[model samples]
Target: MSEDLEFDCGGNRGDGRLIYTVTQISYEIKLILEDSYPTVWILGEISNFKLYNSGHIYFNIKDKNTQIRVVIFQSASINLTFSPKDGMKVLICGRVSSYPKRGDYQVIVNRMERCGSGELYEAYGELKERLKAEGFFDESAKKPIPDIVNKIGIVTSQDGAALCDILKVIDSLNANIETLIYPVRVQGKEAEKEIPQAIEYFNSNHKDLDVLLVGRGGGSVEDLWAFNMESVARAIFASEIPVVSCIGHEVDFTIADFVADMRAPTPSAAAEMVLRSRNDIKKRIEFLRESLNGAINFILYDRSVELDKLILSRALTKPYLIYEDKISYLDELDNRLLKSIGSLFKSKSENLGNVSHRLDIVSPLSVLRRGFSICFDSNNEVIEDSKDVNVGDDISIRFASGSLNAKVKSCE
Candidate 1:
């Protein structure tokens, strides 16, 4: 066997040999492992579990058929929740590679999961319960939908029946509302990442949208798993814009329904929920018009009645008669004044006659006629006796209308 495996010499050399270094051998093994196995999922029971002081985890995965060594780096090791025991079943996600120094193949685990019947479903339920207890489904966390939606954003698949249904509904009911579509995958492994990413994009970008409708048409639980994912639920809850979830049929409820601001049974129903019916608005306008017309007619009728009463009153019909009656009263007063003047003159003549009779009784001439005489000094005067006469004084005497003048010769 040694003679058949002899090495061939090509130039000057100490012996006929082919040389290979440790580093070169290890590099070739690394390339081969990377190219052949790549990344894969391995399910087996854990055995010979060990932890290094460097915080790395070393374990063996074994089945009845075969066994393989596994290593989880320190970064991934610290995040693991469950400890690996010798006989526990696990599913490891990792890349296959060979160690250079020891010349052995192992799996570098990135993630680990416990394997059992309905394990994925169990994980889903556990995560859901945990998030619910954290208040992710509280009513206070929900946003409010706008009353009059003008610009609407939709997150769903681009080539989906739900999109067409929504567009048709909006066009039939409220043609004026504008819609923006954000296309995303609706199912499969990529859906879990793409759907949530699309939701987050709209949350960050679509500030002008009145509301966002996030959903797809009806599907099975597995088909709708993307909407049930924690990533999608968080995106819906954290959205600044109000989200209306329309993910499935009326009977179906998803995590999105609990986290969204509003929920609709279908895409068409979501569109209808956003827009007001045209006939309803028309009926309101007609009712208001009728009320305005009725009010105006009532006011006009009241004003017309007041104006008719004013025109038909006595003051309006017989204004000239009121002036004529006033003039007749003045004429009667003038005739009465003339008759009073004539009566006053007659009374004045009678009063004057009585005054003359009274004056005759008290006259001085009457006293003279009674044989009493008024005496004066001798200048054309009558003497009462001889003593009133002076020597050479002129004297006068009168009786009725006759008079005599004499010179006094003696005085007694």
Candidate 2:
């Protein structure tokens, strides 16, 4: 399809040339630029970087000669690990689009990143260091993966290829394991909260889970930034159940990987590890059953041989022999008992005599019988000093066995 251009050459009628209004020219140029370049990745230095109140980011990507305006809406920009700054060298990927009002072409940025020195990687390293200092990555704190996992929780996007890979492995193994799928955003800003929330939910409420498989498929550093979040690492560390991190490719590692109980190279690898040989469990059980049968037979044979010997022994075959030995043993025991009883009685008698002697020495009646008498006032209180008695006071004299009442006639 083709449209004719109405030529208005400088407002004078019809010189055979295509001269269009400013608006028409701008529209044609915009359509040509947009339709020609569907998408582009531009390398340039950031200048006049601005994040608007409307949550849209505006910036210009420029090299030596010219610059192009760039805009990344909130949805894409929110996933940025590091804040974009002016004078920062960056690589931006977007489509070329024109603003009709200004008639200016700009790149509608879909993604942005620092070019040479990746700010996202630096931020990842910093977060890793911080978590390491906090002992989130300490091997000592890591829980051990159960040798036999019966139930496991999966925290990942339900529809992700990684989940499909994991489920395939698990299903193939025929592992009789209960699986609880906790679907979450695997990438982007929402993933930061969603991933950690799933981990916390499993830890707080799902105590019965044998293990947790937390991860997603491989992606760029920014795309996998959620797994590197501090909250996610803390949640993994806080889990009472063991967590196996299967994040990204074999080469990629996240904070969650370090803090997790175990790290699987991939999601399928994680699934394989969680249930090591479930499909072969029947074979193992059969082998064990044979082993037990053999052991029991061996044990029974040995026991029968011993029983034969015991039955043939003198104790059973010649019953009176046992009774004869037992009779002798009883006599010996009787003599020993008699001697022990006599020795015990002698020792007890000696101990009692010693105790009685000590008691006699400490007895108050012993001192009184040694010819001392106690005097009491009229109130019958013991009078130990002469000052305790007065001339008009009645007194009582107490001997060892008896007491007599007396009236105090003189002071002396």
Candidate 3:
């Protein structure tokens, strides 16, 4: 073979030209793009926007003539103050680079700004006011959180730190409570859609849930944009289950916080609020037990004192003395009764004797006893007149104790 027809082992043909693999050429192109424009600023309208679950944002920035593909990685995107959406005019600062695999040029955005105003903040404010006017944030409409929750439905990213924090707090405090997690994207383009649907599902299917906690850990405004969405807010407002919003850190607030039944500063705080600590409940029960014991002891002591008083009372201790006094009084009455009866009998005897003496003085037999005689004619009637006795008539004379029969000789 000729020297020009032979391939050089050092990556060159017999010609003066160098040969490159597809990867080598792609890498060369990427290096050129990166070196040519290390950083640049562009003003354009956003289109074809998307936020992936990996926390990366992809979109196209277009002017009238042309458009360029842009990407914001998770690290840089986490620092963005607002979410980028289609049709929004934005000014972006980025480094130019190419995807070696696809051999495509793109801008890796590090910072972005709205062309006119803070679009996301303005939208947030406007929607908040409108929903407030519509009574979405009224305290009267908000459901009351139960003092004790049994089952809690959580709507958030399943693998996020927020979920872990909530579960850790709950487990530390109360383990008996059941947590039914309804996982969803907490932040992203699809997050707003998935969150509301999770809430509706819990409300429709798991009515047994005492409360629902919807939230995620601390993040940038763009990362937490899903919670600030109108759809998420409306879903929270419309939920039948009492919703406790735990989004971002203490200082970080979202539309969901206002629309929810309760707002917790953090995911751990939400767990603390929904369920009481096991130690706390045990302490309360112990307090009640002590109170009850105190009351019972007081009552028993009072009853014992009353029983002691009864045992020492005159009616109980000197019971026989009372009966003895009564007996003495009865004996006095009996003696008085006997004395009265004797006096009555003696007076009656004297009166009866006097009456006997008076009757004897007026008796006809008394006259006979005093040496006088009662004469009777033949008819045996007492002779009181001389005419009662006839001459030659038989007569009888009655003395004190004897009667004599004689002939009547004279009258009177």
Candidate 4:
């Protein structure tokens, strides 16, 4: 198939030579536009901003009278200093080129930035997001401010009104906190470096400092830009001592404020925040003293009541009652002892009588008293049977009254 051809200057040329296709024509135009304006800076307000899944951003820069399409490819979008929104005024730098497929010319932006205060504001937001992602602004990372602040280290210009204002407020509140100043520029090219250095120095050298006040007097965002720097933010984050940020008026916010342990609306407010008022402290002390007195008085009164009870005790009141009780107890014990002894003797006497009656039942002497006599042979052994005696044997007869000698005659 043959494609349709057109020529830019075709009326002449005799032999009909300068013929070109639509694609060739579009490429020619694209080259001309790109060469004419290799790079240009344009100022306009963004009307339509669309970020695609392909990582390219499509948008329109519009004025009341006209508008132009702009595309930021992935490479340029990755370097964007801020997240751009519709209606935001911006100054873009890019080269104009035509798309051959659509046969349309547009600006291919290489770099984009916000204009005026928008620039600083955009950087601020970007940094805030980045640091937040890094956990620098986390509550868990922040050190807790002590309830009682004794010494404060200030990082600000010594001559600045911020320092003066802070001192005045501290004096007005009658705070017991003492201050140590580490003078540094609050705004300038050197401020970013000096501020971080000051923070580090104080942290390393002053171990007793309870808190740090970092801020400057009220000014524009540019004037307060030093506090927004990454160095200052990281320095505040790394500090072991609790940092109190008071970078501007109540309405202004900075990166340093987010990274600090505490944030106050103004420098004066920071001073008062770090320490309690002397009047409040005095009231606390007074309350403690009164409580201590109450506790001691209670103890003393209880002990006094106990002493009164002891003084009126029965043993202490009559004294002689002690001896009387003891003597009564001793007499009762003696009577019990005597009764026990007499009972023991009566019991033993009855036992002896019984034993004597038993002995009379079994005693040979009792038999003898009944007129029975025991006969003993020459060997002095008692003869129980008549066969034990001989006719002419001499023997002894044992009577109950007396034993007598006799000669045995006959068994009968």
Candidate 5:
């Protein structure tokens, strides 16, 4: 598509102007309108409101003089904070485009806001900020989702599609999961109060549930307003069981989403996320079984190899040969011991003989045998001086092997 388009006409008029076909003109006008007003904001009061089952809203927005058809496709409509009614004032931002099927000019709205709902949005911001500052959305505060989920508690309207969708998904996965549904009003008066009550109900009564799913199917912002309430958010934050916020569609977000332990875009997705499929579980078991078998086989093979080595070893094969070798070693040790004892004894005997020879060289008896003698006086003491000799004194003289009694005159 170009800013300027050119086309061929079969023939020219008398004025020499080109004629474009209806389809071509419609396309040309669409291009011109889109190009001229790619983006615009309009203020008007809503009228002729129509919300189709497809989730698209077709309505007219007009002041007193004229009205223009506004088309809010499902993609953009789900984000609407308020449902458009016959007399509600609104502001919309959109692009001007031609609808070729109807050959009509319409505005394809991308954003819509209620005329006086700014304060509500402001309050929402304030609460979000407050809760965030208080650590309501902290990741550390979130509980872990159990790896295996056997039971779950749901907080939604019992008759809503969200429950059915969740159950359908669980069934498709063939998970043996049980559900405890706490029915409550998802929207309308007191819906916010009911939502938190339902959450608390499950928490207090059914503490054994593996996880809690608190949400509903896709809806307008007003419909999901219950989830955005502070009470609902706090309840989710305080839940002992892990909470999975499965509110609306992927593009939609609520305060519950931030405070929850986990978030799922839709109820069916929550089911798929929280519970493993039977086939997947079986595959996991099979993988573990194979791994265990491999480990056991490796261990057995290793032990078997060790056992074979032991069986082939000589220590086990030739018992008598080992005993014979031991006997031979003992004989050798005995001979070595005998030689050691004899050598020790001979060394000791030679040392004793040397000591005896040294003693004999200094012995008195040896001196006597060498012709040396000792004398004794009357008290059997040896006299070395000549002055005290008396004729009648008695003394004993020791010779080599005998002693003789003598007079003191022999003192000299």
Candidate 6:
């Protein structure tokens, strides 16, 4: 039976020969692998990992002694619980299959696990520690919230419950203030990057905003991790506009809280802090108006009293009283003038009598009364000497009342 089954087709029976074709051998190996093993687990270090655009992951798993090729379908790769990196030790569970055309074998992975805490989480922690050391969470950089803000910019999910609470509070306080909402992701992996970017965009575009209100409703720390991200903190600190961080329940605090201008216990509280009730302002205005009216009335009463005093004085009520006071004084002045004129006339009469008596005492006619004769020339001039008479000139002799005319005879 052994002799009949001997089939050496490459050479004659007496000569030794070898027979083989690449395609035939490969086909036989594929059949053996398909028939023998369904799937198996492989533990090795990953190498030459590639993610194709078609969503397929291709890689090589290598050990110190051997290595194997791997291909994970797009669906399976997407469902992977952890991200894998080159040189990472992992456990891959899949089926071994042979490629007839390439004449090779590869493992098609359905599941995989990292040797430790995984690549994605490791990167996250590393970045977080680096940012924390750089003081991204420092409180000194925080800004103070304005007591009254009429324009507020909000960064949160559009459909989130936090937005509803904020709106309700704002409406109750002051609805006149404008609120601008910027919708963004609030959770998950994308949130870590997108939330910060959204805040930065608003800061760059809306510089006129009075304040930024960033928040969400209550959630676990992991759920709110986006707010604690370094990018979010840096964005808040660098913003030119003030920020109000209201990122969960009262007990919650994030990195954003430390970097923002102020912190609110909740989203509703943040809204209340930014706006004041209209009733309060109205009450204040009413109080001021009353005080002003009271002051004006007091001033008017004082001025009225001054006017009454001025009217009662002599200068205002009686026009002729001032002239009556001066009339009596005028009579006294006339009496003084008459007495002075009378005294002056009497003194002048006495002086005239004295002068007349002195004239009589010195008269030249007194000499004639004493028996002395008076003589006159023809011209009525007195001839005192006999030698003054000329021959044939007429002369007059007077003795008191009588006079004699005589011709000038021979005079010795």
TM-score of each: 0.45, 0.44, 0.49, 0.46, 0.53, 0.42
User: What would the C-alpha RMSD of candidate 1 be, to one decimal place?
Assistant: 34.7
**What is candidate 5's lDDT per residue for 1-412, written digit by digit as tens?**
4333354563678888888777778887898999998767677889999999999999999989999999999999998877789988787878999987679999999888786744555677789899999999998999988888889998888999999999898888878778898888888768889988888888889999999988899876678878878988888888898999999877567789989999997999998888854456778999999999999999999999999999988899998899999999999999999999999999999999999999999998899998888877677677776664567787777878997887755433
After superposition, the stretches of candidate 1 with alpha carbons farther than 4 Å from their true spots are 1-121, 277-290, 302-412
How large an RMSD does model 5 have? 21.8
Each candidate's lDDT (Cα)? Answer: 0.80, 0.85, 0.87, 0.87, 0.85, 0.79
Worst lDDT run of 10 residues, candidate 5, spans 1-10
Q: List the residue pairs that clash in candidate 6.
A: 143-261
Q: On residues 1-412, what C-alpha lDDT tens digit does candidate 1 reach at each position?
A: 2332243333446776655556566656888997887657676889999999998999899989899989999998887768878888887877899887698889998777665554665666677788789888888887777666788899999999999999998878745877889899998889888887877887777778888989999865568778888888888888888999999777556788878899998988988887654435657889999999999999999999999998987679988887888899889888889889878988998899999989988987777788766545655455667776668877665654555666767776
lDDT by residue (1-412, candidate 4, tens digit) is: 2243343553447886775677777788999999997776676889889999988999899878988899999999998878998998887878999888899888999877677546665687799999999999888998988877778899999989999999998888777677889999999989999999999999999979999999998875579899999999999999999999998877567789889999998998888777664456778999999999999999999999999999999878998999999999999999999999999999999999999999998999999999999999999998989898889999999999998999988877
Order of all candidates by TM-score, from best down to worst?
5, 3, 4, 1, 2, 6
Q: Which 10-residue window in model 6 sums to the lowest lDDT? A: 1-10
Q: Model 3, residue 153: displacement in angstroms?
A: 0.7
Error of 2 at 171 (Å): 1.3
* Better candidate number, 4 or 6, judged by lDDT: 4
Task: Score residue 208 of candidate 4 by CA lDDT.
Answer: 93
Whose lDDT is higher: candidate 1's or candidate 2's?
2
Winning model by TM-score: 5
Residues 1-412, model 3: lDDT tens digits? 3343343443547787687666667777899999998767677899999999999999999988999999999998898777788999887878899998798899998878676655776688799899999999998999998876778899888899999999898777745888899889888889989999999999899998999999999876688889989999999988999999999877567889989999998998988888864456768999999999999999999999999999999899999999999999999999999999999999999999999999999998988888999888788887888886678999888899999999977776
| lDDT digits (tens) for residues 376-403 of candidate 6 | 9999999988898888899999996788
Clashing pairs in 2: none
Identify the runs in model 6 with alpha carbons over 4 angstroms from their true place: 1-140, 143-148, 277-290, 305-412
Q: Who is ahead in TM-score, 2 or 6?
A: 2
Clashes of 1: 0
TM-score of 3: 0.49
